[model samples]
Target chain A: AAGVIQSPRHLIKEKRETATLKCYPIPRHDTVYWYQQGPGQDPQFLISFYEKMQSDKGSIPDRFSAQQFSDYHSELNMSSLELGDSALYFCASSLDKGTGGTDTQYFGPGTRLTVL
Target chain B: AQSVTQLDSHVSVSEGTPVLLRCNYSSSYSPSLFWYVQHPNKGLQLLLKYTSAATLVKGINGFEAEFKKSETSFHLTKPSAHMSDAAEYFCVVTPPGYSSASKIIFGSGTRLSIRP
Candidate 1:
């Protein structure tokens, strides 16, 4: 079974710089979700998209934006990066049933972002 | 509102001893519960999920969880701990009709340590 794939397994950036992360969800999966895990902390929900449409939003910062393309792939763009933004960024894909009876999210390896 | 709480931050067990990771959840409606394991520098893997089907959900690597509605708890357990089982575990809850803004909620996480 093919799992979710993320680009740039590890990234290093300087303050005020910009970065973009990509996520290719599993085949047939229509929902994509983004999360951030800081050092010694649990993963926090950032944002999510269903069928290329923004379905939900969490604690994502204003400097960050994301969009799902027609190919079902998604990208997260961050600008004016800060040192505090350093963390593990994870992408998850799930089959959206519209209802909540079935929404098992499959996660990718994650990208380790280090803002210097 | 839906939230999950992990009872312990860290748990240590012998290689052949039983393993227990406690989790409790609160949801306004019937919620889908899940247990995910994350190894060092790895993505989150689904250990098991409870979608109001079976109270006892079995997962990979000899892991299982029992959902107790009365206690509002879904605790993960294994008969014998393995050295490779050392990882961080998270409890998550997604309420019904979660297609809207309210997404999944994750617990603080519990780090499991296995001793040889």
Candidate 2:
């Protein structure tokens, strides 16, 4: 089966501009998540969608938002990009969030965004 | 609330030697711990995870982690360090149920280096 896939492997945008990144989760997955990774730091949770509802969010700014479609695909949008927004964005998915065992998340290749 | 901390910023080992990456976590309830590996310009990959069921967890690529509730630690280990093992590793912790919102806390990350 094909793993999660992300679009625009690399992106560049000017300060104050808006940028969007897309992700396609694995088939039959019910949960989709977005994460951001800065240089020399671990990946941080941005937001998650499960069953078409916003389940959780991390310490991201209000300018950031996400949407999950009926097909379980997800999109992340960043408004008024800043230099601090330059980082790698990853999309992950899981079958469910059950605590029975390891709800291992499968990730996409990631999208590198540069804000100048 | 939940948080994770990686004890080292970097670790170096000779080829064929054992590899150890230390991690600690804090949680208000029973925690779900995980270890993820990321190569340069790539997305995160699951190494192992520990739920409430077992203390010792084995994962792909010959990696394993032991969860110690008493010490609040979930440290990853490997019998042999391969050159391909050079990458950044992250320790993550999450609360135990749907009410926890599936939110995850990640550590600062530890970069592994292998000597030829």
Best by lDDT: 1
Docking class of 2: medium
Q: Indicate the worst ten consecutive residues by lDDT in candidate 2 chain B.
A: B96-105
Model 1 / residue A69 / CA error / Å:
0.6
**TM-score on B-chain, cand. 1:** 0.95
Q: What value of lDDT does candidate 1 attain over all alpha carbons?
A: 0.92
Candidate 1, B1-116: lDDT as tens digits: 67899999999999999999999999888888999999999999999999888999999999999999989999999999999999999998988645442468889999999999
Off by over 4 Å in 2: A98-102, B99-102
At residue A32, what lDDT does model 2 achieve? 85
lDDT of 1 at B68: 95
User: Measured with DockQ on alpha carbons, how good is candidate 2?
Assistant: 0.53
